[model samples]
Target: MKTSLILGTALALIASAGMAEQITVMSWGGTYSQSQVEAYQKPFTTETGITVVSVDSDNPAIPIKAQVEAGNVTVDVVDIEYADAIRLCDEGLLEEIDPAILPRAPDGTPATDDFLPQGLSDCAVGSIVFSTVYAYDRTRFPDSPPRTIADFFDTGKFPGKRGLKKAPKALLEMALMGDGVPADQVYDLLSTAEGVDRAFAKLDTIKKDVVWWETGAQAPQLLADGEVVLSTAYNGRIFNAAVSEGRPFDMVWDGQVYEYNLFAIPKGAPNKDAALEYIAFATGTQRLADQAKWISYGPARKSSAPLVGLYQDGKTEMAPNMPTNPDNMKNALASSYDFWVDHESELTERFNAWLSAS
Candidate 1:
């Protein structure tokens, strides 16, 4: 009888293990994903026993839309830009996320109040505040480094290949700023056809010297490998390359275009329950701050700031390196989600045509 009981318990344990929950999360690859793995995924798995499968994508939004529309949803969670999240949600491709699922701050502040105003949405929860900024090899510009956005486009003076993202989003805005447009007026100007033409005209100045990158990791690599003297990159990638890998890369924040990166669950996700659990855990007060230690992106939750300290190296301070730092924000531009939502298709189409021309 005792032997029969033991066999039955063993069978139950095996079945439970077979049914264990796991969720796949997709995000931009490189150090950014590594930060999430250490600060969010590891702890989440430890606390809940739900396995997390981290996947890398040049852009998560593309595959998310494709998978949902095809009725073969694979990723349960995705880290997407603010504009993409709104666009996807409006298309009914994402699951509606309730803010109540988020945990309150340690001081008893509601999570809704603690997160930055831009962090929460109908279907998304913000994760980090990162910037699309340009960086240069310190060795390349040791004597007279580029200081402003205009310098990035002044190839005749700087005289080297430039690294730029193939997309129009931040590129257009930076081009306009480099042409002397103020950060506040960038979107207003881009809203017009003449403004669009002007931005492209500025880009025309360095068209022959541009080397394009499609992925975040490639931007830093391009600089390290001497493929380009200067590159527009996610600020955190450049930070990781310098501090972690000892690459002599330095960022130029003058025209930095900053945006919130958010987490969302796709509609019809295979493990929606686990996905929700993971997002709530990952965006909590502590987890958001912990992420800053691994990368320079600012935490999206206000309550998380005090918890943030030195980098994973245990020596480098994380604050001044953040894109949100007042020093960095002197000339920084907040990415306008409304503008992108209204103009992305038109601008992207125009950009493609221009890239293919001549």
Candidate 2:
């Protein structure tokens, strides 16, 4: 009887260990992923005993769509841009995440009311507000650094290779801005054929001097390697290089394009419940604020703003470095989700053709 009882207890222990939960999260790699790891993944695992597996992607949306359509979904959660979140959700590739699952602010504000406008969606929850801004190697352009967007295209003045994202989204908007278009009128003008031509014409000026980067980490490396004097990069990545790594880089916020980065679950996630639990925990007010310490991106929740403080280094103030800072917003443009959803494919094709032309 004693041997049988001991055997039963051993079997039960093995069964319980096998049932421990794990969820995979895909995100744009580099410091951004590191930030999420520190702020969301680590604490989450500690608190819930669920293993969080981190994966890197050039863009999470592509894999999410491919996985869901192929009927072999692997990632449980994805960190995606606001535009992709809406587009993927509309295509039924992502699971619907009810906002009620999110926690309210410490002051008792509801999750919906506490998040910034457009922060909460039918299928995703906003995490950070980041920007695509141009930055230059301070050591390279110590005396006569490029200041405005136009300078990014003026090879005669800046006089070195410029690094740009391989995508047409922010580049088109910035091109028009460089060509002297105002931030507010950029999308309206881009909706017209002539405005599209003007933007491309501006890009043509620096086409030969442009080195295209597909991932967030490559942008900072381009500047560091002296491959490009000025590169348009995600602001948080630049901040990580400049502050944490002590790189001599400075950002040009004039004509910056800012947008939200949200968390979503792909359809058929193996651990759907754990993924939802992770999202709810990560998007909470404190978690959002915690992310700000690791990177310069602004928290998506209004309540998270007050809690934002110094960077992880414990000296550099995070607010002034954020893209949403009042100083940075003077000439900033908000990325239009509607515009991208409508024209991404058409413009991407044109941009690729332009890249191939002699």
Candidate 3:
């Protein structure tokens, strides 16, 4: 049923492109969405006169799948995590994007080589490299800080409520890593049911004191309000809280789950051609570099790294705080898109069951 619906949508979209006027892009809301709007949407609009309608979602991929399955596709392009990008492409919910459509670099390098290894796929193009990192309020843990993944689960040592996201993706990996599973071996161990149970068992230690956050802004807010002592959050969100807002928070880079965010065209889009054009223009070297001014996330294109400069505030250097920074990469684990693609549904069910259990 879903396959037929997706096929129908794709054919309809191909036929409607000439008639459709504007392209709608769905993205994770808040400051991150604002960055894409400033860097890509508006500039694309200015350059081609095609209106880029921006929409917000907790995660765009959810609705993209729903819409494609229902054969009621509305959004043209969506900014989604790498795992979902790969999963949806395999499910035939996205259009196959060609490498030839992407723009060449200023130095004449083709898009295929200029983009980092994680940036390109048959159905999507990555835009940024972001991470899930835990942070603590300095005011709460002044004498000793929560430095490692193990420290995040040590409620006896830390002695405060720990904040975590509601979803299972990174939290499970963090639990495994916190239990002394080597960063490189987290996914391998998690491939089995015993590993899944082990992760939940580790989380059980802190479950009573855990405050779950659903949005990127909520983690930092939880710390600032004295609600949680340690909270896992995007590195950029913590950076904004600690640096931009003058908060006393510090990011814990150990056991971080770094991942890519890709821009993919849904299977049946209202403006298919315009969506392709938008992706090509937005992922260019200058445009991707421009996105970093609004957020600390590293651009997907390697050529854009040299072009990245100061933050919007003009004083802060964006490189030092990026998740891709050399200093932060030592203990980081690249979130396995393949692992989640194969295990997401099953693990998510188990995670929810664990969440509701006594």
Candidate 4:
């Protein structure tokens, strides 16, 4: 009788521990994302007693697809690139989010009203907004900074060397914009055969002067060392470099190409309830605002904007990346994920061929 009672007690304890919630979250590997996890996800787990399995995903879809195919899906939530989120949603790999579970907006506005129009969908929620802009070495060009996309490509005018992203999306848009196409007409122009050729022809003019960046992280290093007078780079990379290295670098957000990172729940996840809680906690107004202080990326929640006063005061020029800033948010161009997803394979093949030729 005593042995049976002890055994029963042990089994009961095991069952209780097993009932504890565990959520697996996958996100891209970067200093900014890491800081977000620490600031938001860690506190959430501490408060709720849930276990978070944070995974760094260079390509989140591969592992997620494999798990689903193997009939052993474990990923609960995923933070993916804006374009990748669209692709996954289109393929029915993500679960629709219920906004009712979300925390109230910081400013007492409706939660749905706080988000940008593109941000309010059911499939995913916007977490951070990053910019692809011109980062120039202030020491090299002390008199004036390259103010626009046109200045970036004009080597003779801004003169010295320039760097551009190796990827085609932003480069294509910048080329069209430089060719005098209005911002509103950029996508329409690229959708045409002559417009596409015209954009490439414009790029060809600066091909020799352009040092193509392989990754977002690489741009800061190149700029700090003065490899090129001006380069297109992620805002976070430039901000971090300036703060850490004290390198004389400045970013110009004029004609910036802004992209969002989204948090989505993968379909067939093992812990949907815990994942939802995690999302609600991470995207909560306070946590979102906290994240902005440590990283250059801006929070999606409008209410979080006022909470970021300290960080904003320190980096006034970086306000353009902030979602609450009307002028910045208004002028920012949202890259078309649909177009990229539709033509990714062909576009990638063409991009690779062109890169190899150059």
Question: Going through the candidates in order, what is the number of backbone clashes in each?
Answer: 0, 0, 0, 0
Expressed as tens digits, the lDDT of each residue in 1-358 for candidate 1 is 9999999999999976655478899998889999999999999989999989999898899999999999999899999999889989999999999999999999999989998868999999999999999999999878899999999999877999999999999999999999999998999999999999999999999999999999888999999999999999999999999999999999999999999999999989988888999999999999999999899999999988888899999999999999888899988899898888889999999999999998
TM-score of each: 0.94, 0.94, 0.91, 0.86
Model 1 alpha-carbon drift over 4 Å, by segment: 1-17
Of 1 and 3, the candidate ahead on lDDT is 1
Q: In order, what is each prediction's RMSD in angstroms? A: 3.1, 2.7, 6.4, 3.2
Ordered by lDDT, highest first, the candidates read 1, 2, 3, 4
Q: Supply the global lDDT for candidate 4.
A: 0.76
The lDDT leader among the candidates is 1
Let me know the TM-score candidate 4 reaches against the reference structure.
Answer: 0.86
Local distance difference test, per candidate?
Answer: 0.93, 0.92, 0.91, 0.76
lDDT (Cα, 0-100) at 332 in candidate 3: 84
- Give per-residue CA lDDT, model 4, range 169-207, as digits (tens): 777877878777777788887877788788788888888
- The superposed Cα distance between candidate 4 and the true structure at residue 33, in angstroms, equals 1.6
Better of 3 and 4 by TM-score: 3
Model 2 error, position 116 (Å): 1.4
Cα lDDT, model 2, residue 301: 96
Which of the two candidates, 1 or 4, achieves a greater TM-score against the reference? Answer: 1
